[model samples]
Target: MSERLRLYSYWRSSAAYRVRIGLNLKGLSYETVPVHLVRDGGEQHTPQFRAANPQGLVPVLVHGSRTFRQSMAILEYLDETWPSPPLLPGVARERARVRALAQAVACEIHPLNNLRVLQHLENALGLDADARSQWVRHWIGEGFAAIEAMLAEHPSTGRFCEGDTPSLADCCLIPQVYNARRFKLDMAPYPTIERIEAECLALPAFDAARPENQPDAA
Candidate 1:
């Protein structure tokens, strides 16, 4: 039986963008239901969206009878349910390494720089625009520094984060790079990171997920 695949997405959301790239890479067709994150203090907080995802986040994938949230979780779900064009490589160690790299960006870097966090820092904590910019740059720099060192020193690194093919690590890296660029962070320090990101951006899947191409992007 053919299953229904639906993605509850926010066009400019880096997390949702990640899922879109994964779906594209796997050649899975899914309808994009845009959940406007910015309108009316974020539609994700509304009762409608909350019923779909208790976490009230976008990038919720409804497949058949199942629903999945969390960008990395959704990617893994897609890969597991449809094993062709695998996103993670063989070998348990290699998979773990790639997952670690992804989490470094998704968990450590993104949480601090997300829209809600920035808004909280400003409207709630009284941080000025300058301070907020610094906050964004600081976390992005820290995360990218670690990723840069990993790619530079680790023998596992190749054309992408792991082997020649783009893996989950690359999926996570590109969105974070996009976020960094949006904030105008200097990229010269992370040559390998920048190089891999450029390579990923050249691919159509990653290009399609870019913020500027999204419906909500201004």
Candidate 2:
């Protein structure tokens, strides 16, 4: 029998959205257990949720008896375990390049604009709404500027971030693009990024993983 897959995710969490795209691309069927991040002081802070992930973050994947945390790690695990439609390129250097592109968004951009960070900006640092929005846009713009150049100048760039097929980079990029749109960031400056996002979203797998399409979306 195949192992059961369960995803503990928040509807709007970009990290969770990345995992969802990976799973869908790999043609894996999984159950989504919604963890409302905002209602009632954030359900992710609950004892039960924390027990699943001590970090109190969403996009935790339970496959059989194994539990995986972090979206990028989960994507790697899925690609390794189910190699049919690989997420990373087969060549060593290509794989590294793809991962670096993925991390450029996952590590550098997403962290600064995460929900908790924004919440802290408002609650702890006492930044007003305009300031908070500016903060989000500033970091996204800074990170995207580099990514746009990387993609635009690189010969490896295709319909997707790497080559025509979607990779881990696309999984990370798409969600960050979604978050950018949510914050009303000007996407015209990053034409290459916008083009890649458009290509990815045109595919069924990427479309299915959208935040608004999730089971727990409001």
Candidate 3:
């Protein structure tokens, strides 16, 4: 085994979940360093955590002497450094398509619904619980609508987001779908997303990376 790979992760953090899924898909073993975002006014805000990630985000991957942040960056790094069981395709166009689909969830959908952002909507903007819930549902619906359209129309979509093999798209989709389900977002409109998530979850990699399966899960 390589020297212990340390991951700063929060149990319910969808970004962290994406990295965990990537690591598992590569068959790489790692140690979990739980970062409780909700406790003590957000442990990620602490100086030490901030030192690892100036942005104070969870899912920072420390391998050997190098530390990486951003879920998509970490996933791409893992795929590049360890090519076996590749999470991306060999073709340039196909790879771009896969990354775009992943970004639809990671960049476009997730940020607005992240824990810190929601906390801001409550504490900063003074949005009540119902309003916050509406905010969450609105973004999830907008993102999933695009995803559903792509999955339905894209000829590249197969059993998973891209072709039959699980790609970066599946990694991103599963976690976002999990978050959507948590908020009781209606999945009826996104049958393709639901089907893809189900297929990915059936695999050992995605199953093992589930939030509840993590050590820090409440």
| Clash count list over all predictions | 0, 0, 0
Question: Clashing residue pairs, candidate 3?
Answer: none
Regions more than 4 Å wrong, model 3: none
Worst 10 residues of 2 by lDDT: 1-10
The TM-scores of all predictions, comma-separated, are 0.97, 0.99, 0.98
Cα lDDT of model 1 by residue, 1-218, tens digit: 27989999988788998898898888888888889988898999999889999998888999988889999999998889887788999899999999999999999999999988999999999999999999999999999999899889999899899989888888888989988998889999999999898889999988987878876677
Candidate 1: global Cα-lDDT? 0.90
Q: Which residue pairs collide in model 1, if any? A: none
Q: Candidates' lDDT values, in order?
A: 0.90, 0.95, 0.94
Q: Report the lDDT tens digits of candidate 3 across residue range 161-196.
A: 999999999999999999998999999999999899
Deviation (Å) of 79 in candidate 1: 0.7
Predict model 3's lDDT versus the native: 0.94
lDDT of 2 by residue, 1-218 (tens): 28999999988999999999999999999999999999999999999989989999988999999899999999999998998799999999999989999999998999999989999999999999999999999999999999999999999999999999999999999999999999999999999999999999999999999999999999
Which 10 successive residues of model 3 have the least lDDT summed?
1-10
